[model samples]
Target: MTNQTSEQFWEERYRNMTGQPSGRPTGKLVEFAEALPPGRALELGCSRGDDAIWLASRGWQVVGVDISATALAVAAERAKAAGVSERVRWEGHDLAQSFPEGMFELVTALYFQSPIAFPRAEVLRRAAEAVAPGGVFLLVEHSTAAPWSFKSRTPFSTVEETLASLQLDESWEPILVGAPKREARGPQGQTAEVLDNVIVLRKRPA
Candidate 1:
Protein backbone atom coordinates (compact mmCIF):
# COMPACT_ATOMS: atom_id res chain seq x y z
CA MET A 1 0.00 0.00 0.00
CA THR A 2 1.20 3.51 -0.75
CA ASN A 3 2.02 5.55 2.32
CA GLN A 4 -1.12 7.53 2.91
CA THR A 5 0.82 10.06 4.93
CA SER A 6 3.03 11.04 2.06
CA GLU A 7 2.61 14.38 0.31
CA GLN A 8 2.48 12.68 -3.06
CA PHE A 9 -0.39 10.43 -2.05
CA TRP A 10 -2.49 13.29 -0.68
CA GLU A 11 -1.66 15.53 -3.59
CA GLU A 12 -2.87 12.92 -6.03
CA ARG A 13 -6.06 12.43 -4.08
CA TYR A 14 -6.82 16.14 -3.99
CA ARG A 15 -5.95 16.62 -7.63
CA ASN A 16 -8.72 14.23 -8.59
CA MET A 17 -11.34 15.76 -6.36
CA THR A 18 -14.13 17.78 -7.97
CA GLY A 19 -16.05 20.87 -6.92
CA GLN A 20 -15.26 23.37 -4.16
CA PRO A 21 -15.57 23.12 -0.41
CA SER A 22 -19.06 23.00 1.09
CA GLY A 23 -18.42 26.38 2.76
CA ARG A 24 -19.88 25.08 6.02
CA PRO A 25 -17.62 24.65 9.00
CA THR A 26 -17.85 21.55 11.10
CA GLY A 27 -20.52 21.76 13.74
CA LYS A 28 -18.10 21.05 16.55
CA LEU A 29 -15.78 23.87 15.50
CA VAL A 30 -18.54 26.38 15.21
CA GLU A 31 -20.09 25.29 18.50
CA PHE A 32 -16.89 25.63 20.49
CA ALA A 33 -15.27 28.53 18.69
CA GLU A 34 -18.24 30.84 18.53
CA ALA A 35 -17.88 31.82 22.18
CA LEU A 36 -14.13 32.35 22.21
CA PRO A 37 -12.52 35.65 21.29
CA PRO A 38 -10.70 35.91 17.97
CA GLY A 39 -7.04 35.02 17.85
CA ARG A 40 -4.47 33.11 15.84
CA ALA A 41 -5.87 29.72 14.84
CA LEU A 42 -4.21 26.64 13.37
CA GLU A 43 -6.07 23.93 11.50
CA LEU A 44 -4.37 20.59 11.03
CA GLY A 45 -5.26 18.75 7.79
CA CYS A 46 -7.35 21.62 6.55
CA SER A 47 -8.59 19.82 3.42
CA ARG A 48 -10.41 22.49 1.39
CA GLY A 49 -10.08 25.45 3.81
CA ASP A 50 -13.78 25.68 4.61
CA ASP A 51 -13.22 25.69 8.34
CA ALA A 52 -10.20 27.95 8.06
CA ILE A 53 -12.10 30.43 5.93
CA TRP A 54 -14.96 30.38 8.40
CA LEU A 55 -12.58 31.24 11.22
CA ALA A 56 -11.01 33.96 9.09
CA SER A 57 -14.42 35.40 8.42
CA ARG A 58 -14.96 35.52 12.17
CA GLY A 59 -11.97 37.85 12.72
CA TRP A 60 -9.45 35.12 13.54
CA GLN A 61 -6.18 34.96 11.70
CA VAL A 62 -5.94 31.38 10.48
CA VAL A 63 -3.10 29.21 9.25
CA GLY A 64 -4.37 26.18 7.34
CA VAL A 65 -1.97 23.28 7.01
CA ASP A 66 -2.54 20.39 4.65
CA ILE A 67 -0.49 17.61 3.17
CA SER A 68 -1.68 18.24 -0.37
CA ALA A 69 -0.34 21.20 -2.30
CA THR A 70 -3.19 20.90 -4.77
CA ALA A 71 -5.71 21.23 -2.01
CA LEU A 72 -3.89 24.24 -0.64
CA ALA A 73 -3.91 25.95 -4.01
CA VAL A 74 -7.60 25.35 -4.50
CA ALA A 75 -8.38 26.45 -0.98
CA ALA A 76 -6.34 29.61 -1.42
CA GLU A 77 -8.32 30.48 -4.52
CA ARG A 78 -11.55 29.88 -2.66
CA ALA A 79 -10.38 32.06 0.21
CA LYS A 80 -9.51 34.85 -2.18
CA ALA A 81 -12.95 34.63 -3.73
CA ALA A 82 -14.50 34.73 -0.29
CA GLY A 83 -12.89 38.14 0.31
CA VAL A 84 -11.06 36.93 3.43
CA SER A 85 -7.78 36.27 1.67
CA GLU A 86 -5.79 38.39 4.11
CA ARG A 87 -7.12 36.54 7.13
CA VAL A 88 -6.01 33.09 6.03
CA ARG A 89 -2.72 31.53 5.02
CA TRP A 90 -2.13 28.07 3.57
CA GLU A 91 0.83 25.73 3.98
CA GLY A 92 1.55 22.23 2.72
CA HIS A 93 3.41 19.71 4.83
CA ASP A 94 3.48 16.03 5.43
CA LEU A 95 2.87 15.83 9.16
CA ALA A 96 5.13 12.81 9.33
CA GLN A 97 7.90 14.90 7.87
CA SER A 98 7.32 18.50 8.98
CA PHE A 99 5.02 20.84 10.88
CA PRO A 100 4.24 24.53 10.66
CA GLU A 101 6.01 26.97 12.98
CA GLY A 102 4.64 29.32 15.66
CA MET A 103 2.06 28.93 18.37
CA PHE A 104 -1.65 29.55 18.09
CA GLU A 105 -4.48 30.54 20.41
CA LEU A 106 -6.61 27.76 18.91
CA VAL A 107 -5.43 24.47 17.39
CA THR A 108 -7.89 22.03 15.93
CA ALA A 109 -7.79 18.57 14.38
CA LEU A 110 -11.20 17.59 13.21
CA TYR A 111 -11.73 14.08 11.83
CA PHE A 112 -7.99 13.78 11.42
CA GLN A 113 -7.82 10.08 10.67
CA SER A 114 -6.41 8.00 7.86
CA PRO A 115 -7.24 4.61 6.43
CA ILE A 116 -3.58 3.67 6.30
CA ALA A 117 -0.93 3.45 9.00
CA PHE A 118 0.63 6.72 10.16
CA PRO A 119 2.15 8.36 13.22
CA ARG A 120 -1.05 10.03 14.27
CA ALA A 121 -0.33 10.21 17.99
CA GLU A 122 3.00 11.91 17.48
CA VAL A 123 1.45 14.46 15.13
CA LEU A 124 -1.34 15.21 17.59
CA ARG A 125 1.15 15.66 20.41
CA ARG A 126 2.98 18.16 18.29
CA ALA A 127 -0.32 19.85 17.65
CA ALA A 128 -0.87 20.12 21.39
CA GLU A 129 2.53 21.70 21.85
CA ALA A 130 1.61 24.39 19.30
CA VAL A 131 -1.16 25.71 21.49
CA ALA A 132 -0.13 28.87 23.32
CA PRO A 133 -0.67 29.36 27.01
CA GLY A 134 -4.37 29.54 27.87
CA GLY A 135 -5.06 28.39 24.32
CA VAL A 136 -7.59 25.75 23.34
CA PHE A 137 -6.82 22.47 21.60
CA LEU A 138 -9.81 20.70 20.19
CA LEU A 139 -9.77 17.23 18.63
CA VAL A 140 -12.71 15.51 17.05
CA GLU A 141 -12.06 11.99 15.79
CA HIS A 142 -14.13 9.16 14.44
CA SER A 143 -15.22 6.75 17.12
CA THR A 144 -17.31 4.93 14.52
CA ALA A 145 -16.49 5.39 10.89
CA ALA A 146 -19.12 6.23 8.36
CA PRO A 147 -20.44 3.46 6.15
CA TRP A 148 -18.78 4.90 3.09
CA SER A 149 -15.45 5.50 4.80
CA PHE A 150 -12.42 3.44 3.98
CA LYS A 151 -11.94 2.76 7.70
CA SER A 152 -15.43 1.46 8.12
CA ARG A 153 -14.36 -1.77 9.79
CA THR A 154 -11.41 -0.35 11.65
CA PRO A 155 -11.50 -0.25 15.40
CA PHE A 156 -11.45 3.27 16.73
CA SER A 157 -9.69 4.61 19.81
CA THR A 158 -11.82 5.80 22.66
CA VAL A 159 -11.47 9.11 24.46
CA GLU A 160 -9.47 7.48 27.26
CA GLU A 161 -7.26 5.68 24.81
CA THR A 162 -6.48 8.87 22.86
CA LEU A 163 -5.81 10.86 26.02
CA ALA A 164 -3.43 8.19 27.20
CA SER A 165 -1.55 8.46 23.95
CA LEU A 166 -1.42 12.29 24.25
CA GLN A 167 -0.01 12.00 27.81
CA LEU A 168 -1.22 15.45 28.75
CA ASP A 169 -0.03 16.85 32.04
CA GLU A 170 -1.81 18.78 34.80
CA SER A 171 -1.07 22.00 32.96
CA TRP A 172 -3.74 21.03 30.46
CA GLU A 173 -7.30 21.33 31.61
CA PRO A 174 -9.80 18.97 30.04
CA ILE A 175 -12.89 20.89 29.07
CA LEU A 176 -14.75 18.09 27.31
CA VAL A 177 -14.09 14.43 26.61
CA GLY A 178 -16.81 12.14 25.38
CA ALA A 179 -18.23 10.19 22.48
CA PRO A 180 -21.05 11.97 20.74
CA LYS A 181 -23.30 10.48 18.07
CA ARG A 182 -24.36 12.49 15.09
CA GLU A 183 -25.96 12.12 11.71
CA ALA A 184 -23.27 12.04 9.06
CA ARG A 185 -23.88 12.73 5.40
CA GLY A 186 -21.90 10.73 2.92
CA PRO A 187 -20.45 11.90 -0.40
CA GLN A 188 -23.51 10.78 -2.37
CA GLY A 189 -25.98 12.34 0.05
CA GLN A 190 -26.40 9.18 2.06
CA THR A 191 -26.85 9.72 5.78
CA ALA A 192 -25.75 7.42 8.56
CA GLU A 193 -25.30 7.40 12.29
CA VAL A 194 -21.76 8.05 13.34
CA LEU A 195 -19.98 8.60 16.61
CA ASP A 196 -17.16 11.04 17.27
CA ASN A 197 -14.65 11.20 20.08
CA VAL A 198 -14.46 14.83 21.12
CA ILE A 199 -11.65 16.17 23.27
CA VAL A 200 -11.34 19.85 24.13
CA LEU A 201 -8.49 21.00 26.33
CA ARG A 202 -7.16 24.34 27.49
CA LYS A 203 -3.53 24.94 28.36
CA ARG A 204 -3.24 26.70 31.69
CA PRO A 205 -2.12 30.29 31.51
CA ALA A 206 1.20 31.05 33.14
Candidate 2:
Protein backbone atom coordinates (compact mmCIF):
# COMPACT_ATOMS: atom_id res chain seq x y z
CA MET A 1 0.00 0.00 0.00
CA THR A 2 1.13 3.55 -0.70
CA ASN A 3 1.67 6.10 2.05
CA GLN A 4 1.28 9.85 1.95
CA THR A 5 4.60 10.32 3.72
CA SER A 6 6.34 8.78 0.76
CA GLU A 7 5.84 10.58 -2.52
CA GLN A 8 8.14 8.04 -4.04
CA PHE A 9 5.45 5.38 -3.81
CA TRP A 10 3.27 7.29 -6.25
CA GLU A 11 6.26 8.42 -8.27
CA GLU A 12 7.33 4.81 -8.66
CA ARG A 13 3.85 3.61 -9.52
CA TYR A 14 3.60 5.97 -12.46
CA ARG A 15 7.18 5.35 -13.46
CA ASN A 16 6.52 1.60 -13.65
CA MET A 17 2.90 1.42 -14.77
CA THR A 18 2.37 0.68 -18.41
CA GLY A 19 -0.84 1.77 -20.08
CA GLN A 20 -2.32 4.24 -22.49
CA PRO A 21 -4.16 7.32 -21.42
CA SER A 22 -7.88 6.74 -20.94
CA GLY A 23 -8.60 9.23 -23.70
CA ARG A 24 -12.33 9.02 -23.29
CA PRO A 25 -13.60 11.71 -20.99
CA THR A 26 -15.68 10.73 -17.99
CA GLY A 27 -19.21 10.13 -19.25
CA LYS A 28 -20.78 12.05 -16.38
CA LEU A 29 -18.51 15.02 -17.06
CA VAL A 30 -19.45 15.14 -20.72
CA GLU A 31 -23.16 14.60 -20.08
CA PHE A 32 -23.32 17.57 -17.74
CA ALA A 33 -20.62 19.93 -19.00
CA GLU A 34 -20.78 19.54 -22.79
CA ALA A 35 -23.12 22.45 -23.15
CA LEU A 36 -21.61 24.74 -20.54
CA PRO A 37 -19.43 27.54 -21.84
CA PRO A 38 -15.72 26.97 -21.32
CA GLY A 39 -13.72 28.76 -18.65
CA ARG A 40 -10.90 28.15 -16.16
CA ALA A 41 -10.83 24.60 -14.78
CA LEU A 42 -8.95 22.64 -12.12
CA GLU A 43 -8.60 18.87 -11.90
CA LEU A 44 -7.40 17.21 -8.70
CA GLY A 45 -5.38 14.04 -8.97
CA CYS A 46 -5.47 14.29 -12.72
CA SER A 47 -3.74 10.93 -13.36
CA ARG A 48 -2.71 11.00 -17.01
CA GLY A 49 -4.30 14.35 -17.85
CA ASP A 50 -6.98 13.02 -20.16
CA ASP A 51 -9.73 14.98 -18.44
CA ALA A 52 -7.62 18.15 -18.45
CA ILE A 53 -6.83 17.62 -22.10
CA TRP A 54 -10.49 17.20 -22.84
CA LEU A 55 -11.27 20.41 -21.00
CA ALA A 56 -8.50 22.25 -22.81
CA SER A 57 -9.78 20.98 -26.13
CA ARG A 58 -13.12 22.53 -25.19
CA GLY A 59 -11.49 25.93 -24.51
CA TRP A 60 -11.15 25.71 -20.74
CA GLN A 61 -7.80 26.95 -19.45
CA VAL A 62 -6.85 24.01 -17.22
CA VAL A 63 -4.48 23.36 -14.34
CA GLY A 64 -3.95 19.67 -13.76
CA VAL A 65 -2.39 18.65 -10.43
CA ASP A 66 -1.01 15.42 -9.03
CA ILE A 67 1.58 14.28 -6.49
CA SER A 68 3.40 12.04 -8.93
CA ALA A 69 6.00 13.68 -11.07
CA THR A 70 6.10 10.71 -13.43
CA ALA A 71 2.36 10.93 -13.95
CA LEU A 72 2.56 14.65 -14.57
CA ALA A 73 5.36 14.01 -17.02
CA VAL A 74 3.17 11.70 -19.06
CA ALA A 75 0.31 14.14 -18.80
CA ALA A 76 2.54 16.92 -20.09
CA GLU A 77 3.48 14.75 -23.02
CA ARG A 78 -0.15 14.07 -23.75
CA ALA A 79 -0.98 17.75 -23.60
CA LYS A 80 1.79 18.55 -26.02
CA ALA A 81 0.79 15.72 -28.31
CA ALA A 82 -2.82 16.94 -28.31
CA GLY A 83 -1.67 20.46 -29.20
CA VAL A 84 -3.41 21.84 -26.11
CA SER A 85 -0.22 22.67 -24.23
CA GLU A 86 -0.88 26.37 -24.52
CA ARG A 87 -4.17 26.04 -22.72
CA VAL A 88 -3.22 23.51 -20.06
CA ARG A 89 -0.63 23.65 -17.29
CA TRP A 90 0.53 20.49 -15.54
CA GLU A 91 1.40 21.00 -11.89
CA GLY A 92 2.96 18.76 -9.25
CA HIS A 93 1.62 19.13 -5.77
CA ASP A 94 1.18 16.97 -2.71
CA LEU A 95 -2.39 18.07 -2.22
CA ALA A 96 -2.29 16.98 1.40
CA GLN A 97 0.31 19.65 1.93
CA SER A 98 -0.85 22.38 -0.45
CA PHE A 99 -3.04 23.17 -3.45
CA PRO A 100 -2.53 24.92 -6.73
CA GLU A 101 -3.14 28.64 -6.51
CA GLY A 102 -6.07 30.34 -8.24
CA MET A 103 -9.84 30.13 -8.42
CA PHE A 104 -11.52 28.15 -11.14
CA GLU A 105 -14.79 28.03 -13.07
CA LEU A 106 -15.00 24.23 -12.89
CA VAL A 107 -13.33 22.03 -10.26
CA THR A 108 -13.34 18.27 -10.39
CA ALA A 109 -12.13 15.28 -8.38
CA LEU A 110 -13.03 12.24 -10.42
CA TYR A 111 -12.00 8.91 -8.89
CA PHE A 112 -9.47 10.70 -6.73
CA GLN A 113 -9.46 7.95 -4.12
CA SER A 114 -6.14 6.88 -2.70
CA PRO A 115 -5.09 3.57 -1.19
CA ILE A 116 -3.45 5.49 1.59
CA ALA A 117 -5.73 7.55 3.80
CA PHE A 118 -5.44 11.31 3.26
CA PRO A 119 -7.34 14.47 4.05
CA ARG A 120 -9.65 14.10 1.07
CA ALA A 121 -12.78 15.55 2.63
CA GLU A 122 -10.87 18.58 3.80
CA VAL A 123 -9.24 18.92 0.43
CA LEU A 124 -12.68 18.77 -1.13
CA ARG A 125 -13.89 21.55 1.11
CA ARG A 126 -11.02 23.69 -0.11
CA ALA A 127 -11.86 22.73 -3.66
CA ALA A 128 -15.36 24.10 -3.16
CA GLU A 129 -13.99 27.29 -1.66
CA ALA A 130 -11.81 27.82 -4.73
CA VAL A 131 -14.75 27.62 -7.13
CA ALA A 132 -15.70 31.02 -8.43
CA PRO A 133 -19.26 32.14 -8.02
CA GLY A 134 -21.34 30.70 -10.87
CA GLY A 135 -18.77 27.96 -11.15
CA VAL A 136 -19.36 24.25 -10.65
CA PHE A 137 -17.73 21.66 -8.39
CA LEU A 138 -18.03 18.12 -9.71
CA LEU A 139 -17.25 14.96 -7.77
CA VAL A 140 -17.53 11.41 -9.03
CA GLU A 141 -16.67 8.45 -6.81
CA HIS A 142 -17.06 4.72 -7.03
CA SER A 143 -20.07 3.55 -5.08
CA THR A 144 -19.01 -0.07 -4.89
CA ALA A 145 -16.22 -2.39 -5.79
CA ALA A 146 -16.20 -4.02 -9.20
CA PRO A 147 -15.45 -7.69 -9.69
CA TRP A 148 -12.47 -6.92 -11.85
CA SER A 149 -11.16 -3.96 -9.92
CA PHE A 150 -8.06 -3.98 -7.71
CA LYS A 151 -8.99 -1.02 -5.57
CA SER A 152 -9.15 -1.10 -1.80
CA ARG A 153 -12.37 -2.53 -0.36
CA THR A 154 -12.96 0.62 1.61
CA PRO A 155 -16.59 1.59 1.55
CA PHE A 156 -17.27 4.71 -0.41
CA SER A 157 -18.59 7.83 1.25
CA THR A 158 -22.15 8.59 0.22
CA VAL A 159 -23.13 11.74 -1.60
CA GLU A 160 -24.92 12.92 1.49
CA GLU A 161 -21.83 12.40 3.62
CA THR A 162 -19.72 14.23 1.09
CA LEU A 163 -22.13 17.13 0.90
CA ALA A 164 -22.28 17.30 4.64
CA SER A 165 -18.53 17.46 4.89
CA LEU A 166 -18.49 20.56 2.74
CA GLN A 167 -20.89 22.36 5.09
CA LEU A 168 -22.01 24.65 2.30
CA ASP A 169 -24.88 27.05 2.78
CA GLU A 170 -27.82 27.84 0.50
CA SER A 171 -25.39 29.72 -1.66
CA TRP A 172 -24.51 26.39 -3.17
CA GLU A 173 -27.09 24.60 -5.25
CA PRO A 174 -26.96 20.86 -5.54
CA ILE A 175 -27.38 19.83 -9.14
CA LEU A 176 -27.14 16.06 -8.62
CA VAL A 177 -26.44 14.00 -5.53
CA GLY A 178 -27.04 10.27 -5.75
CA ALA A 179 -25.64 6.94 -6.79
CA PRO A 180 -26.31 6.00 -10.38
CA LYS A 181 -25.82 2.65 -12.06
CA ARG A 182 -23.57 1.97 -15.02
CA GLU A 183 -22.06 -0.97 -16.87
CA ALA A 184 -18.32 -1.51 -16.89
CA ARG A 185 -15.77 -3.88 -18.38
CA GLY A 186 -12.84 -5.54 -16.66
CA PRO A 187 -9.33 -5.94 -17.95
CA GLN A 188 -10.23 -9.45 -19.03
CA GLY A 189 -13.08 -8.19 -21.19
CA GLN A 190 -15.63 -9.26 -18.60
CA THR A 191 -18.60 -7.05 -17.93
CA ALA A 192 -20.43 -6.07 -14.77
CA GLU A 193 -22.76 -3.49 -13.37
CA VAL A 194 -21.52 -0.77 -11.05
CA LEU A 195 -22.85 2.24 -9.25
CA ASP A 196 -21.17 5.63 -9.13
CA ASN A 197 -21.76 8.43 -6.67
CA VAL A 198 -22.05 11.70 -8.54
CA ILE A 199 -22.30 15.17 -7.03
CA VAL A 200 -22.59 18.38 -8.99
CA LEU A 201 -22.98 21.74 -7.27
CA ARG A 202 -22.91 25.30 -8.46
CA LYS A 203 -22.17 28.34 -6.33
CA ARG A 204 -24.73 31.11 -6.56
CA PRO A 205 -23.41 34.22 -8.23
CA ALA A 206 -22.60 36.95 -5.76
Candidate 3:
Protein backbone atom coordinates (compact mmCIF):
# COMPACT_ATOMS: atom_id res chain seq x y z
CA MET A 1 0.00 0.00 0.00
CA THR A 2 1.21 3.53 -0.75
CA ASN A 3 1.94 5.88 2.13
CA GLN A 4 -0.51 8.43 0.73
CA THR A 5 -3.41 5.99 0.98
CA SER A 6 -3.56 6.28 4.79
CA GLU A 7 -7.13 6.48 6.10
CA GLN A 8 -8.68 5.75 2.75
CA PHE A 9 -6.95 2.40 2.78
CA TRP A 10 -8.50 1.57 6.14
CA GLU A 11 -11.87 2.84 5.03
CA GLU A 12 -11.80 0.51 2.11
CA ARG A 13 -10.84 -2.38 4.32
CA TYR A 14 -13.93 -1.83 6.46
CA ARG A 15 -16.21 -1.02 3.57
CA ASN A 16 -15.61 -4.40 2.02
CA MET A 17 -15.98 -6.33 5.24
CA THR A 18 -19.45 -7.74 5.84
CA GLY A 19 -19.54 -6.93 9.52
CA GLN A 20 -17.45 -5.92 12.49
CA PRO A 21 -14.42 -8.02 13.29
CA SER A 22 -14.88 -10.22 16.32
CA GLY A 23 -12.41 -9.73 19.18
CA ARG A 24 -12.59 -8.88 22.81
CA PRO A 25 -10.71 -6.05 24.44
CA THR A 26 -6.97 -6.59 24.54
CA GLY A 27 -5.86 -8.11 27.85
CA LYS A 28 -3.64 -5.12 28.57
CA LEU A 29 -6.51 -2.66 28.17
CA VAL A 30 -8.84 -4.68 30.37
CA GLU A 31 -6.20 -4.96 33.07
CA PHE A 32 -5.34 -1.27 33.02
CA ALA A 33 -8.95 -0.09 32.91
CA GLU A 34 -9.87 -2.28 35.84
CA ALA A 35 -7.32 -0.46 37.97
CA LEU A 36 -7.95 3.02 36.62
CA PRO A 37 -10.21 5.72 37.99
CA PRO A 38 -13.40 5.71 36.00
CA GLY A 39 -14.40 8.83 34.11
CA ARG A 40 -14.28 10.08 30.55
CA ALA A 41 -12.41 7.65 28.33
CA LEU A 42 -11.13 7.85 24.78
CA GLU A 43 -10.47 4.87 22.54
CA LEU A 44 -8.14 5.44 19.60
CA GLY A 45 -8.44 3.24 16.57
CA CYS A 46 -11.67 1.78 17.80
CA SER A 47 -12.57 -0.44 14.88
CA ARG A 48 -16.10 -1.66 15.59
CA GLY A 49 -16.59 -0.35 19.15
CA ASP A 50 -16.23 -3.53 21.17
CA ASP A 51 -13.83 -1.99 23.68
CA ALA A 52 -15.49 1.42 23.74
CA ILE A 53 -18.96 -0.06 24.15
CA TRP A 54 -17.69 -2.29 26.90
CA LEU A 55 -16.29 0.71 28.73
CA ALA A 56 -19.53 2.63 28.37
CA SER A 57 -21.46 -0.28 29.80
CA ARG A 58 -19.30 0.03 32.89
CA GLY A 59 -20.49 3.64 33.32
CA TRP A 60 -17.68 5.59 31.73
CA GLN A 61 -18.39 8.21 29.11
CA VAL A 62 -16.56 7.05 26.00
CA VAL A 63 -15.39 8.51 22.72
CA GLY A 64 -14.32 5.98 20.08
CA VAL A 65 -12.32 7.22 17.11
CA ASP A 66 -11.08 5.65 13.93
CA ILE A 67 -9.73 6.74 10.55
CA SER A 68 -12.45 4.96 8.63
CA ALA A 69 -15.98 6.21 8.29
CA THR A 70 -17.20 2.73 7.43
CA ALA A 71 -15.76 1.41 10.65
CA LEU A 72 -17.24 4.23 12.67
CA ALA A 73 -20.64 3.64 11.10
CA VAL A 74 -20.50 -0.01 12.05
CA ALA A 75 -19.42 0.90 15.57
CA ALA A 76 -22.30 3.33 15.93
CA GLU A 77 -24.71 0.67 14.78
CA ARG A 78 -23.25 -1.76 17.27
CA ALA A 79 -23.65 0.78 20.06
CA LYS A 80 -27.27 1.32 19.14
CA ALA A 81 -27.88 -2.39 18.95
CA ALA A 82 -26.33 -2.87 22.36
CA GLY A 83 -28.51 -0.11 23.78
CA VAL A 84 -25.52 2.04 24.83
CA SER A 85 -25.77 4.62 22.08
CA GLU A 86 -26.07 7.45 24.57
CA ARG A 87 -22.85 6.55 26.30
CA VAL A 88 -20.47 6.48 23.35
CA ARG A 89 -19.52 8.90 20.59
CA TRP A 90 -17.93 7.67 17.39
CA GLU A 91 -15.72 9.97 15.31
CA GLY A 92 -13.78 9.61 12.08
CA HIS A 93 -10.26 10.95 12.44
CA ASP A 94 -6.81 10.48 10.98
CA LEU A 95 -4.22 10.26 13.70
CA ALA A 96 -1.33 10.70 11.26
CA GLN A 97 -2.52 14.21 10.48
CA SER A 98 -3.85 15.37 13.89
CA PHE A 99 -5.20 14.02 17.16
CA PRO A 100 -8.45 15.17 18.67
CA GLU A 101 -8.09 17.79 21.39
CA GLY A 102 -9.57 17.08 24.80
CA MET A 103 -8.37 15.91 28.16
CA PHE A 104 -9.58 12.46 29.02
CA GLU A 105 -9.33 10.50 32.27
CA LEU A 106 -8.22 7.47 30.28
CA VAL A 107 -7.07 7.07 26.69
CA THR A 108 -6.31 3.81 24.95
CA ALA A 109 -4.88 2.78 21.59
CA LEU A 110 -5.12 -0.93 21.01
CA TYR A 111 -3.45 -2.63 18.08
CA PHE A 112 -2.66 0.61 16.26
CA GLN A 113 -0.14 -0.65 13.75
CA SER A 114 1.76 1.95 11.74
CA PRO A 115 3.22 1.90 8.26
CA ILE A 116 7.01 1.89 8.03
CA ALA A 117 7.03 5.19 6.15
CA PHE A 118 5.14 7.01 8.91
CA PRO A 119 6.87 8.54 11.93
CA ARG A 120 5.52 6.46 14.82
CA ALA A 121 7.15 8.62 17.46
CA GLU A 122 5.20 11.70 16.44
CA VAL A 123 1.93 9.80 16.71
CA LEU A 124 2.78 8.41 20.13
CA ARG A 125 3.77 11.84 21.41
CA ARG A 126 0.48 13.30 20.27
CA ALA A 127 -1.36 10.45 21.99
CA ALA A 128 0.45 11.17 25.23
CA GLU A 129 -0.43 14.85 25.13
CA ALA A 130 -4.11 14.01 24.88
CA VAL A 131 -4.20 12.49 28.34
CA ALA A 132 -5.49 14.60 31.18
CA PRO A 133 -3.58 15.04 34.43
CA GLY A 134 -3.83 12.05 36.76
CA GLY A 135 -5.08 10.15 33.78
CA VAL A 136 -3.88 6.92 32.25
CA PHE A 137 -2.62 6.39 28.70
CA LEU A 138 -2.52 2.80 27.53
CA LEU A 139 -1.09 1.44 24.28
CA VAL A 140 -1.45 -2.14 23.17
CA GLU A 141 0.25 -2.96 19.89
CA HIS A 142 1.12 -6.14 18.07
CA SER A 143 4.77 -6.93 18.75
CA THR A 144 5.05 -10.10 16.75
CA ALA A 145 6.34 -9.86 13.20
CA ALA A 146 3.79 -12.43 12.18
CA PRO A 147 3.94 -13.72 8.64
CA TRP A 148 0.30 -12.91 8.02
CA SER A 149 0.76 -9.15 8.52
CA PHE A 150 3.95 -9.08 6.49
CA LYS A 151 1.99 -9.15 3.27
CA SER A 152 0.23 -5.93 4.28
CA ARG A 153 3.60 -4.15 4.68
CA THR A 154 2.60 -2.62 8.00
CA PRO A 155 5.56 -1.88 10.25
CA PHE A 156 5.48 -3.41 13.70
CA SER A 157 7.77 -1.75 16.25
CA THR A 158 8.84 -3.43 19.45
CA VAL A 159 7.52 -2.00 22.71
CA GLU A 160 10.96 -0.99 24.00
CA GLU A 161 11.96 0.73 20.79
CA THR A 162 8.80 2.83 20.61
CA LEU A 163 9.00 3.87 24.27
CA ALA A 164 12.59 4.99 23.89
CA SER A 165 11.63 7.33 21.08
CA LEU A 166 9.16 9.24 23.23
CA GLN A 167 10.29 12.40 25.11
CA LEU A 168 7.86 11.98 27.98
CA ASP A 169 7.97 14.31 30.95
CA GLU A 170 9.10 13.13 34.38
CA SER A 171 5.54 13.23 35.56
CA TRP A 172 4.61 10.42 33.25
CA GLU A 173 5.20 7.20 35.17
CA PRO A 174 5.46 3.85 33.48
CA ILE A 175 3.18 1.19 34.91
CA LEU A 176 3.89 -1.67 32.51
CA VAL A 177 6.12 -2.04 29.46
CA GLY A 178 6.86 -5.44 28.01
CA ALA A 179 5.89 -8.08 25.51
CA PRO A 180 3.42 -10.60 26.84
CA LYS A 181 2.35 -13.82 25.27
CA ARG A 182 -1.34 -14.60 25.18
CA GLU A 183 -3.57 -17.20 23.65
CA ALA A 184 -5.65 -15.99 20.74
CA ARG A 185 -7.88 -17.66 18.19
CA GLY A 186 -6.63 -17.47 14.66
CA PRO A 187 -8.67 -16.91 11.52
CA GLN A 188 -9.07 -20.60 10.87
CA GLY A 189 -10.46 -21.23 14.34
CA GLN A 190 -7.21 -22.49 15.74
CA THR A 191 -5.64 -21.26 18.94
CA ALA A 192 -2.24 -19.63 18.56
CA GLU A 193 0.38 -17.74 20.48
CA VAL A 194 0.11 -13.98 20.09
CA LEU A 195 2.73 -11.55 21.25
CA ASP A 196 1.63 -8.08 22.17
CA ASN A 197 3.50 -5.14 23.66
CA VAL A 198 1.66 -3.14 26.27
CA ILE A 199 2.51 0.26 27.73
CA VAL A 200 0.61 1.97 30.52
CA LEU A 201 1.55 5.49 31.52
CA ARG A 202 0.01 7.68 34.18
CA LYS A 203 0.21 11.46 34.00
CA ARG A 204 1.06 13.04 37.32
CA PRO A 205 -1.02 15.94 38.52
CA ALA A 206 0.65 19.24 37.71
Q: Considering summed lDDT, which 10 consecutive residues are worst modelled in model 3?
A: 146-155
Cα lDDT tens digits, model 1, 78-189, are 9999999999989988887899999999999998887656789999999999999999999999998777877532589988999889989999999999999999998899
The local lDDT score (0 to 100) that residue 200 gets in candidate 2 is 94
Question: What would the per-residue lDDT of candidate 2 be over residues 1-206, giving only the tens digit for each residue?
Answer: 54345377678778888777778899888987788899999999998888999999999999999999888999999999999999999889989899999999999999888767778888999899999999999999887878777676367777788779888989999999989998887766788999888999999999
Better of 2 and 3 by lDDT: 2
Candidate 3 lDDT, tens digit per residue, 36-66?
A: 6579998888998889988887888898988
Error of 1 at 45 (Å): 0.0
| Global lDDT of each candidate | 0.90, 0.88, 0.80
Best by lDDT: 1
What are the per-model C-alpha RMSD values against the true structure?
1.5, 1.5, 2.0
Steric clash pairs (candidate 1) = none
- TM-score of every model? 0.95, 0.94, 0.90
Give the distance in Å from residue 86's predicted Cα in candidate 3 to where it truly belongs.
Answer: 1.5
The best candidate by TM-score is 1
